[model samples]
Target: MISRASLRFSLGRFTTAEEIDAAAAKLVAVVTHLRQNAPAFEFD
Candidate 1:
C-alpha cells in the first residue's frame, strides 16, 4: 500500500517537472505491482 506519507514525500521534495514526472512514474509502478499481485483486493 502506498501511504500518504510516501506521496507527500515524493511531491514535496520534487520541484522540477522532470522530478515530478519521475515521482509519478514511480507511483504508477507501485500501483501496477500491487494490482498485479493482488487482483482480488479492492483499492477503494
Candidate 2:
C-alpha cells in the first residue's frame, strides 16, 4: 500500500497544477507503483 505520507510527500513539493489532471496523474502514478510492487495486495 502507498501510504498517505508518500502521497503527501509527492504533493508537498509541487506548487502548481492543482486541478484534475494533476490529481489524476498523481493517482495514476500511485496506482501504477502499487500495482507493480504490491501485486498480492487487494485494491478492492
Residue 14, candidate 1: how far off, in angstroms?
6.4
Candidate 2, poorest ten consecutive residues by summed lDDT: 2-11
Clashes of each: 0, 0
Q: Which stretches of candidate 1 lie over 4 Å from their true place?
A: 1-14, 39-44
lDDT of 1 by residue, 1-44 (tens): 43333434634553888987897899899988876776453434
lDDT per residue (tens digit) for residues 1-44 in model 2:
43433544344454566665777898899888877786454443
Ten-residue stretch with the least lDDT total in model 1 = 1-10
| Reference-based lDDT, residue 18, model 1 | 91
Instruction: Provide the RMSD of all predictions against the true structure, rounded to 1 decimal.
Output: 5.1, 5.9
Question: Candidate 2 — which pairs collide?
Answer: none
Return the TM-score for each candidate structure.
Answer: 0.53, 0.46
